[model samples]
Target: MVNTRDLRVIAVLISLLFTAFFVLIILFRGEIDTAATATVESYGLVAIFLGVFLLELLPQYISPHLLVINAIFLGFHIVPIILVSILGHIFASLLGFHLGKVYGFRLVEKLYSDKTVSKISSGMDRYGRWIVLLSAFLPFPYIPVIFGSLDLTWKNFWIFGIIPRAISFALLGFGLSFLTF
Candidate 1:
């Protein structure tokens, strides 16, 4: 087994590869086919990779549309979406955790504003894990902004984030499955 840092590197590299592939397709989309789409689905870590890699650029949040993109557009099986969403949530949470850790609460506070960070901190202190679950279901940009504020361990974050994310994607699967062949 490798270290966590190495694993993060690998995940990031794999994600970049997928992103490069997507860029290529979009650049010349007339040639794309279901096989290309299927290949992306097979990556299994695309969503997590994308979220972790783009965490800063993407406003550091989770959303329902993200799940739908993972479930329907990414072309993965229902199970994969659930699994990836959990892992993605973990990866995303970890990204935010380290940001908080590296930057420290004060620096992070400066990034937002004293009052806003205080409000978010207060919310996390008050709401705790249920807010994480709500963020998973509500489809707003809560994970990075809120869960990141809590600064919990990756283990706890995954437990709270994954269960609800998987449930949401599973529901998406059951709902979408009905409309397909």
Candidate 2:
């Protein structure tokens, strides 16, 4: 069985790994965006699906919204972009939720600063399911792990989290179209 020391070690390692990822993202934002845009242009919706899936499944890489926006600027229809993104995001969120259920928040807690954790936990405690909705609608990370770790019901997660996420994407697609390229 893993002892407290072992768990702490694992948490530290995870923290380091995520920190490295965040640093890379900051350092290579332009290159990553160009490469991501090239991939979507080359592969089309398939690239968007995979990119969104992987980004959502893992933490601290990149936001899938960027990919969707890239697709928009690339002249792909908003409908397909929203549809593909929602599908990819929902699947990833479900898997992340299950991962939370299996693993709990101990390891995940290491991923964020203490203040961020407090915000997430407090928002969850005070607002309950609405936290999921807000997270979905806003630019907040769709961290199903936190929701699942907090023992949110699947129905609530779907209704408050998944659905609103889809709606937000739809809104983004439509709303962004109004802006000049």
Candidate 3:
């Protein structure tokens, strides 16, 4: 029978999966955009807030246009975008970590226990903090998902998580800002 820990893991998994799908929608412009831009500043702010919430609750970052939204609103400065993404992702990862530790690793192990993931998890643990940085810098599909799947330590997650993600985000912002240059 499923217990509270099982339920917690399930909830987190559901949130992550949902975020993945939402990221796809954002990537493909699948959502209706008719009233998106014309909407008031408050609407835009609300959207950003929601995006941040998703990042906190899920493992997808920069995938669902979170970085882009920040870049758009805060201007194309690499610093702000990087800072925001790093902080956002760090917090998200930490939240997941605490949940896993408090609830127990059994739930995470059960959910993410595919053959390939087994190998990935081992490698991730072996590499330790470095993995966080790499995951942060690398492109999507694997990074965030793996982090949540593995149920890493919050402290390690923040240290390794912040550097690469924040830097990559800065790079994106600067690149976009320089488009006219």
Candidate 4:
């Protein structure tokens, strides 16, 4: 069964992954920026839509915010970018949550024993709201399957996960509007 220690270790590992990703972005900013520019030039807003959708939908350990930031810095209009981002995030959230709802428990059970699953279920029962909300707002994994396997209600997930995430993207989009360079 997964214990508190295991959870802590997982947290640390995720933190390290985000840190590594940021470091890589800083180190390869020029290359990444160039590629992003090329992508936007080649595909236009479709690129933004797909980038945000895929990044948020998949377990790629990359943030969709990067694409948004790039679009802003590339001189795209903020309103359309934010609108597309919200759509992408919302669609991804819906699919991810449904996937979790449908397949999360079975997949998790295959990986972990029944006892562990039971314990996890109970823990989720106790703290699923906080977990969902935290994952939504924080830079955590943001995997909706965990929310689904844990049995978070759709209402709770919508309120905590979808709304907060959309707001975050909108806020980031607007906030980046102020950047001069």
- The most accurate candidate by TM-score is 2
Native-vs-model 3 lDDT? 0.53
> What lDDT score is found at residue 114 in candidate 1?
53
CA shift of 8, model 1, Å: 29
Q: Give TM-scores for every candidate, taking all chains together and pairing residue i with residue i.
A: 0.53, 0.72, 0.56, 0.69
lDDT of 2 by residue, 1-181 (tens): 2354665676578657756755665566667667766665568888778878887776533467777766675567788888999899889999988887778778567554455557778899999889889888776767887778888999999999988888887888888887624
**Which residue runs does candidate 4 get wrong by more than 4 Å?**
1-42, 108-126
- What's the residue-level lDDT of 141 in candidate 3? 30
Comparing 3 with 4 on TM-score, the higher-scoring candidate is 4
Give per-residue CA lDDT, model 1, range 49-123, as digits (tens).
Answer: 565335422333224334444344444565555565555555555666566656566556544545546665675
lDDT of each: 0.55, 0.75, 0.53, 0.73
Model 3 RMSD vs true structure: 7.1
Arrange candidates by TM-score, descending: 2, 4, 3, 1
- Lowest summed lDDT across 10 adjacent residues in model 1 is found at 56-65
Candidate 3: tens digits of C-alpha lDDT, residues 100-167: 56655455554444443565577687986676676566653334445655666556665677555655
For lDDT, the strongest prediction is 2
> What's the TM for model 2?
0.72
Q: Model 4: what TM-score?
A: 0.69
Q: Is candidate 2 or candidate 3 better by lDDT?
A: 2
> Candidate 2 local accuracy as lDDT?
0.75
Candidate 4 root-mean-square deviation in Å: 5.6
| 1 or 2, greater by TM-score | 2
